[model samples]
Target: MQELKIERLVKRYPGRDQVIAVNHVDVEVQAGEMLVLLGPSGCGKTTLLRCVAGLEDAQEGRILLEGQPVFDASSGMNQPTHLRDIGMVFQNYSLWPHMTVQANVEYPLRARGAKADDRARRAAEVLEVVQCAHLSDRIPAMLSGGQQQRIALARALAPRPKVMLLDEPLSNLDALLRVELRAHLRAIHRELGFTGIYVTHDQIEAFNLGTRVAVMNAGRIEQLGSASQVYERPATEYVARFLGIRNSLAIDPQGGWHAGPTPLAGDLGRLDQHQGPMQLYVRPPSVSVLPADAPAPGPGQIVLSGARVKDVLYAGGEIDFVVELGQATLYATMRVGGAAPRASDPVRIQFASSDALLYRNGQLIDG
Candidate 1:
């Protein structure tokens, strides 16, 4: 497996004082592993991927594949995309309408001067790997969306590139097809042991596919870690909220915050020392909904009594409730088929201190 490294990478488009698309960012990927660049639109994830693919020249820093220099601004060295030994699958399946699936897949191998028999054999092998061998003779216009995507994958893999780059490869498919293709892609990766870097704004996809997920925002990497690490312990409020954290309550200076009628324990004084007003954040799943008649037990627990359920959404494995606590509305989730409270019925919402995260001025406080 080859190691891919980016050292102080930067990309700036020429404009008034230069528009910085990608700032000084550094990342390293181990060979035969999948690393995902995850963020919202225009967060520099795509720019970084293009730089590593040698499709874009970096204005600063360097890119190295297996210790071989691919891009270096100081040395004025930039390899062309075709010579980078990288396969790219774009969001749009760039299949040729004039050519059949077999011809499209064989084009790359043929361009490299492989024998016609060898190219045909390799094309068949890659198409089989992508599970599109059956449709090799069919034109992309006649194929389903998923089938076309698989053909694109087959084409990308036909040349057996050392690095695989995917740019939101499943975004074009339907939800069901996306899930199915995701499984197929992972299985193929395991079979080939290919080094890959995936770029996507979907957090769930990043969590499921990435060996390490790097969260980007405003042309900067906010956090980089394992799936659970980024979800459970985010470095900033942007990361937490982006990951779908819902409940946020103001913190008092006395080291606690009111959750309706109950005070939740937190280090508000320490949080205030940072900047802006102190607030507490909690994920929806972490908030527990108890029976209204339940006994009040334990200290440092924030329990909101008399919260009326405003609405309920039936998710697959859980039920999401929009509960009204006086004038404030909060969301909570509970396991489906376990126990359910009726809508418009009063319920007690309880959450532990450990589940609450402190943030001040849109930034997470170090606890």
Candidate 2:
């Protein structure tokens, strides 16, 4: 097990002008732990990963493996990919078309000058670890996508590299195959306890696989924390809105909002520190709908009437409803076991003060 660290990493392309792909990104991966670099497309996650793998020459920063510097631009020290002792699994399964599975798996060991018998034994062992030993004689074209991926994984691991870099390894597979391969990848990580840095744009995969996820945007890390921490307490409005949070309403500290017969209360929270107008964010599941005839709640809950259900969608386990409150539309998701209201029916909507996050100018503000 070896720890990986990247400090002040910067990658820029100089042509007629300059294009900065990775902007001074710093990342640390604990030994035997999986760290995921997650973000939207073209956010420099892949570029950063390549730098760590010694595949790309970073214009700045230092890459350290197990406390030793592998790359230092100022010192003019940059290790080659093969000499860095890192395994790379690309998005495209980089398998040799003419070679059998066993031959491909044995290639890495052979390059390291292992004996023929030793290479064959290590190849078989790694294939068994990836559960592809039975198809060791099959060529690349004879295997399914998932099977080919397993072979690629086996080849990467056959040499027992100090670190592993996976670049969207499951992105090309179908949804079902992707899910199955994700589970297998997680299992392999657990069994081998190898340091891994995985890059992907899929939030589901990041949440499922990453021990700690670093959310990136526009070539910078927006937030880095556990999955639940990032999801529940997003530091920025971009993260909240991007994560599918739908309910956003502007709030005024001076009691400025008026919705039909109900005047928006000024007692929600103090928005004095926030500049300009303030916005409130709430998850769909936090908002609930009550029957029109139901009595008002006691305290800390805003009760809005005259809301008509605009649509009802029945998902697998939950019933989602779109409700129109005054002129604004809000979504509420209720479990299927609960009673669902009909569309176009007037209902009272309620939400807690704590469930709402206050934001101003696209940034989260303390409420």
Q: TM-score of each candidate? A: 0.88, 0.88
Q: Candidate 2 on 1-367: residue-level lDDT in tens?
A: 3499889989997887677879988888889888988888888999889888888898999999999999999998998888988898999998999999999999999899999999999999989888888999999999999999989999999999989999999998999999999999999999998889999988889989998888888778888888877777777887787677898776554455444444553234443445455677889998887778877675677656778899999898888999998768889988846567889988888788668777777877753
Candidate 2 Cα outliers beyond 4 Å, as residue runs: 15-18, 256-277, 298-302, 337-339, 360-367
Find the 10 residues in a row with the least total lDDT in model 1: 264-273
Candidate 1 per-residue C-alpha lDDT over 1-367 given as tens digits, one digit per residue, 9 for 90 to 100: 4479889988999978777878899888898889998998988888888998888888899999888998999999998888888899989999999999999999888888999999999998999898888998899899999999999999999998889999999999999999999999989989998889999999989988888899998778889998888877877888987888888776454434454455533223434355444667889998877668877747656666778888999899888999887667788998956568878888888777668788767766752
Model 2 reaches what TM-score against the true structure?
A: 0.88
In Å, residue 22's CA in model 2 sits off its true spot by 1.1
